[model samples]
Target: MTASASESGNTVAAVDLGSNSFHMVVARLQGGELRVVDRIKTMVRLGEGVDARGRLDPAVRERALEALDRFGQRLRGLPRGSVRVVGTNTLRVMRDAQGFQAAAESALGHGVEVVSGVEEARLIYLGVAHSLGDDGQRRLVVDIGGGSTELIVGEGVMPLHMDSLEMGCVRLARQCFPKGRYTPRALDRAALRVAQELEPVARRYHNAHWAQAVGASGTVRAVQAVLKGLDLSPDAITLDGLLRLRECLTRAGRESSLDLPGLDADRRPVFAGGVMVLLGVFQGLGIQRMVASDGALREGVLHDLLGRMASRDVRDQAITAMMARYHVDAEQANRVSGTARHLFGQVRRAWGLDDEAEAWLRWAAETHEIGLDIAHGSYHRHGEYLARHSDLSGFSSQDQAVLAALIRCHRRKISRKALDAVPDNRRLRVERLIPLLRLATVLHRSRLDDALPAVALRRRDDRLDLRFPAGWLEAHPLTRADLAEESTALKRLGLALRVR
Candidate 1:
């Protein structure tokens, strides 16, 4: 669901749950143009608490919730789907992530989505590109976060290549600058680690690929500021200034002693780590200088959300591409899609579905047979795997789970485990959705476009009565057997499928 300017909410807010800080941006869309209204950021150092078991420490968890409590209050009165809260790095790799996500959503009064690292690079590019507003120069955008760093090279607003590396401020600082102490040896070791991280992808993002270099997010901006404070390359980050800053840090010998212009107290602990990454990036990518941008993940999310509100959803394009890639039978997919939509109209209200459900049905109908390219036997499972694991731009992890579940249970015995994979709140609606998709596929098993008689569907709680034209079932024995088999499958999901 996307927010629209036509709706009561001309105001849209994007909240970025970063490992280092929680940032929120509220913008108003008026006459198709976005205007910034409010922005707030709070440092939480969430990555610091991730243990070997992948759990957030209890104290860190409490601190995170407290920060979310404040963010949620600011988002008060915003309509659902208008406020987008995205989690990066920490949330993506955390153990029991679903549990934390649910609690976070409760506090924020909005759904929270964790994007893949590659997707994170894409969003960061979206934000930086929009801020720059397409100068026609190919640019390399770099964003260093607490637990990860993203490098994106793009022309105008479209990113051509992207990479997200494991090196980040918090993780690296903990490794190389513990107790806020940075020695010459420690800095060199950190530089080496950053090099190894970039070794494979550095060439692809080197100077030859992009005409200009731009940095986004907190760490990069801080580095740009510190260079000016020291009066060493006051305009942008030059390699010489970065090296000078490294020397300054080694001379201080401790985070407490290091003092420079534009270095905030909160940043001191992780400052050395961020600088080391910048140094390695410069050396590895042959960068002479780099400037900073006001845009980052939060802004990118706003623009992406705006695109969604305007109905330019990237997920639609992703589904279309998947269909072509997997060699789906276009005609058969069309038949199933049409029937599913038809069935949906009858049961939507009764089953508590909305526009989002319609979208799920359409996508499921179009891509249901994708697994046929892999093999006919258990094609449903193959389709599920594709939906579950593929990097479908703009589809959240929860969104993928829902799509996967629908495809998995479209035929044969419904996979209870597949349905269970869907988030708790939306599980029931997906269960109801499965039977409708199954019915569509069952009706079109012959894969002929000869057109069947109009079928009417009525729903009463968990029971769905599917009525065909008079004598239609008797005339089509094969479809009847298909429905009989479907009835058994529906029983497992606690749904009744009565065909008369």
Candidate 2:
């Protein structure tokens, strides 16, 4: 398909649910650049006090929802594709995230994507790199959030190496300075913890690998503010400056005593923890100097959404990469994909499907055979596993879940269990998509290059009727039998398929 950049509206919004704060950026997409018209940031500290079982404290959950309710108001009437909302470390670690996600989506009136750590790192790098443009120089990007820290090594807009460390401002603060004290001992312990987190990936990210370093997100920016605010490191972020800041913070004794000029009051409690994490990066990575970027994840999201509108989606790249990795049959996959797209166009309007659903159907058709590499027996299950677990860049956990569910139901007896993998809100439409994918694969079961006869597909409430060229099914007896069995199989999914 030809790529199209035209979208419903030029205005787009990105909401970032960071561990420490929630931020929203509304921008106008013009000539491939983002012009910010409105911005919102609220400190809800969503990462604080998350239990081991991945449950947030009730008060913290309430606080997060309240903040999202306000964000939803601003985003109330925006077109679906015009806004992108993502949750980072806090949501990622939340085991029962779907429960909270349901409430959060209700308040926001939009779906929330819980992105993987590496994906978050990629978005962070995208945000930081866009501001710098493509300098053709390798650089290190660091973003400190409330629950995790992302470090990316990249040249221009692409990230070559990325890692999301478990250490974050809010998590570390509660661990080392529960009472908000910044004593030397507590600070040393926090520093040690940060060093340990970086130990595994420090070699690839050290100063020797990058031309320059850039800091991003709230924590690093807060540190920048304090350093300049206090005249400690008026011109640059240096280890020396960090050392002096640490001294000042330690001398102050506690968060309440902190009097840094550039630090926001809301950031005070977690400031010490953020500082320690950044300081450790400076030391561990041997970063001599660093600069800050105004852009972060939300900006990256807007850029990504813009790409999606333009049909330059990075997720498509991810799908292609995955197909290549799994040794997918390009020819056969194309045959199925073309057929699926053809059928989707037939029933899209009748069934109320949209571009997103069409995209998912096409992806499922293309990669349905990814599991054949694992084993010829029940390859569908293997494909489903890989789809669910593999870190396909640009896909949220829920996105992966939906894609996996589609892959799972692409063949064999459709099961309620497989459809259950999809989130509740989307299950109904996906129920509609499953049969299309199954039918497409069934029609292409021969895996030949021969052209298929035109098939007219119509949706009538709960039943789908497919009419082929006169006597096409009689000439293709194998397909006739496959369709006969397919009809019975789809009955498990409560759908009636009629082939003529």
Candidate 3:
């Protein structure tokens, strides 16, 4: 896909490969607001397909692929950046997720991003905040998926505290109610286990922090429906209402034979387990009531896409925050960014680098020195550590990996092994961009505002030829020597850099 196609689309779509269900939302941008045009959701029970060994069952893989094929049909003709697809907890935990991801991408005709749990929490908050309107009240948003539960506290659209618990409905169901029977003992065990999981973060989410509690995801929506249908709660999910629903489930005994009011047949299988998780959340966090939100990860994804299209990307804000936290030199960062952008423009077309690549490069260039905050010695490694492990909002797991790789290799010795560690499809791009970043950084090593002479860069197969104006190299002998040394480093990575 061309850069133009990615940036110039009115229609956008988001696909969430959730643990229990796969969901896709297509929205149209009109009057600066997203209008939902289509939504598709299918219960694939993706979490249930993973065994104790974390390997995805073949049958489950087939179900997931079939579902993606269907989603692919709806997503056809969407521009490259017009669509964003994310894989959640089940894919995160799968031992062989790469295999599934590759197949899924093929089925969907787009790349799939596997986001970190904290990032997932942020997206959930974004969805909930946009859906609930801008009341300016701090909210506690909880999302219970098939394999994980995300808890977030935020005001407006910014998430202040976020956490992703390892427990979820499908996981709890598999562990405690494998036989499909909802015995009191099983319910007790599930709730107790969930409570134990929430114990550490319970105090952080107590009533004092947030104005109101909100729930997003199918489990909570189903629970709210059941509560209203049973007349336990008219418009909200309350502790007492959840307890009553628990009693009814216990009375029903088995999930398959159980019939409940306002419960969809599709949700019946995981309904009991979902209730157990919500019960744990309510009891552990001391939440009296939680109102359901119509939006979730999918909506959040769309809104984030919109932000990117509108140049209000949270990622830029996140990078800025990181810079502030690390005390990065803004002037130096801007210099490096400017130099990198100039170099990128010279070779982007030849190297097939898109706007996304340029964006990553610019962000890396701006924040590559973050590790200096920790210590000057081996700061690049420190920077890489922070970039890879930190809970950076708006960045997917893959984004972190690539960004970290670039930072790790931005200075000192450039290692092919480090570049090889990046995602398979992105290795070449990282390799191409690393030299550009290194050159840019080297040019600004003096941190001076002196005007730089125009330099030309051309790529020929595995070789990069760099030509500077006459006498520029001699006038800047230090830069010349740096370029000479960089040539050797490039050779180690199987690339030839010719400086003239």
lDDT of 3: 0.90
Q: Quote the positional error of residue 87 for candidate 2 in Å.
A: 0.6
Best of the candidates, lDDT: 3
Q: Provide TM-scores for the models.
A: 0.96, 0.95, 0.95
Segments in model 3 whose C-alpha atoms lie over 4 Å from true places: 1-9
Clashing pairs in 3: none
> What are the Cα lDDT values of the candidates?
0.89, 0.88, 0.90
Question: For all the candidates, what are their Cα RMSDs to the real structure?
Answer: 2.4, 3.6, 2.7
Candidate 1, residues 1-500, lDDT tens digits: the string is 32334543589999999989999998988888889978889999999889767988989888988988888888877887788888889998899889989999988888999888888899999999999898889999999999999999998888889888998999899888877788888888999999999999999999998899999999998998888888888789999998998899989999889888899999988989999998999999999999999989999999999898889988898899999999998889999999999999998888789998898889998999888889999999999999999878888788889999999889999898998899998888888788888998988988887887989999987788998989899999999999999888889988788889
Candidate 1: residue 195 Cα off by (Å): 1.2
Using TM-score as the yardstick, the better of models 1 and 2 is 1
Q: Per-residue lDDT for 74 in model 1?
A: 80
Over the stretch 127-216, how does candidate 2's per-residue lDDT look in tens digits?
A: 888988987999999998999999999998999999999999999998899998888899999999999999999998988899999999
Which 10 consecutive residues of model 1 have the lowest summed lDDT?
Answer: 1-10
Indicate the TM-score of model 1: 0.96
Ranking by TM-score: 1, 3, 2
Model 3 residue 275 CA deviation (Å) reads 0.6
Candidate with better lDDT, 2 vs 3:
3
What lDDT score goes with residue 134 in model 3?
A: 77
